[model samples]
Target: MTPTRARYDAVADFYASGWPDAIDDPASLRLLTLLEPIAGRRILDLACGHGRITRELARRGAAQVVGVDLSAALLERARAAERDNPLGIHYIHADVTTWSTPDQYDAVTCNFGLSDIDDLDAALATAARALRPGGLFVCSLLHPCFPGGPNVSGSWPSGGRYHDEGWWQATGELSSLRRQVGANHRTLATYLNAIRRQGLWLDELSEPEPSRDWASGRPDAARFPVFLVMRWVKATAQP
Candidate 1:
């Protein structure tokens, strides 16, 4: 297994219990808002952890929903939820970077998941291929430009600059999840350029306002964007 998958597998139990079913974080809320009119849309969620957002997609009336992840323990939790709640969300045990499907989807989403994936280009290409022509590819992530303020770790290591893109683990209390599993850091341009390369056109971009509690706690970090939400579209023709 890849380090990312193994690292997360080690922490799957903690993660599965820690996060509530109804997520209220600003980043996730912003992403959900952009996923409107979800009644009957076929959706695929990449790097889906415990099926939180995937369940949300199903709950919001997605016609069919599939969630793919690399963690076996996490997939078990997701499958358990599906068995208990019967949301019809199919959970797949696979990595987003290498997984394939004959079926395409109307919309593809990755909630704060891209940064955790080591092969950003491969993952983006997979997402692109999973989309039907003119379908939507939407995602949210921790803002790369966020220079951390007091107590919080920004998008990169404390010693690392924003332009320094690679893998690093956080040590801050605010970065509980990342501290355990680490994350991949990439520049905004890298993501945009890769999306373009995959024939996914940028449709909308959002830098959501930080929550009052977070802003008050880390004013400096709040000064910069805390989260990024993007919507892209698969073109009818590829380059």
Candidate 2:
């Protein structure tokens, strides 16, 4: 596992404990909604941490569902969950940056995992390669702007240097914000451009609504979008 994913594996237990905001997380929900899988279509859940949506896809009647992650710790938990249902989900522990899949899936999804990936281009390329022509590539990531301010570094009035807001960054414990924890950060433009480079045509862009609970308790949560959802189709070089 890569250093970033490994870090998440070590902390996988925290998420399973019912990440307080799990139900309110719009990123994963948006991706799942866009997938719209048929009962027998093959689906790939790239970087499926703890198999949350992975299980959902299988339950929704996908013919084959595969969840790949770089962290063994999280994969272990995913495996445990699969054991209960035994729907035959293939769990792979590998880095998406280098993994490859032939034209094997009707759809590929990356829910809240793109921004954390180091090689965004390679990852998108892999997703594109894995899909048959005209197949869909659905993914969600941190909004390039808003919510977290400018992801810049500067000195605050408190007289200490600190890293400011950034894409795909979350603050955890000790008033410290961790950037690029399980994945790296990328701008919205960068994402679109990368998908194009991977022979995928942008189809739609969506921003999911934060759950009612989150909006009520965290006023600023909706003010700044915390997630972005995108749908793309494989390009066919035809007139």
lDDT of 1 by residue, 66-185 (tens): 999988888899999899999989988888888889999999999989988888989999999999999999999999887777768888888878899999988887767888888888
Candidate 1: residue pairs that collide: none
Listing every candidate in turn, what is its Cα RMSD in Å to the true structure after a full C-alpha superposition? 1.8, 4.7
The reply for model 1, stretches above 4 Å from the true place, is: 1-5
For model 2, give the 10-residue run with minimal summed lDDT: 152-161
Give the Cα lDDT of each candidate. Answer: 0.88, 0.70
Q: How does candidate 1 fare on TM-score?
A: 0.95
Write one digit per residue (lDDT tens) for candidate 2, span 1-239: 25344667656777566543243477777777788854788999898888887788887799999998888888898898889778779998888888876547999998778756777778887898788888899988656653333332111212222233233334422213242243354456667888888888889899777677755655544566656799999876643
How many clashing residue pairs are found in candidate 1? 0
- The best candidate by TM-score is 1
What is the lDDT, from 0 to 100, of the residue 101 in candidate 1? 90
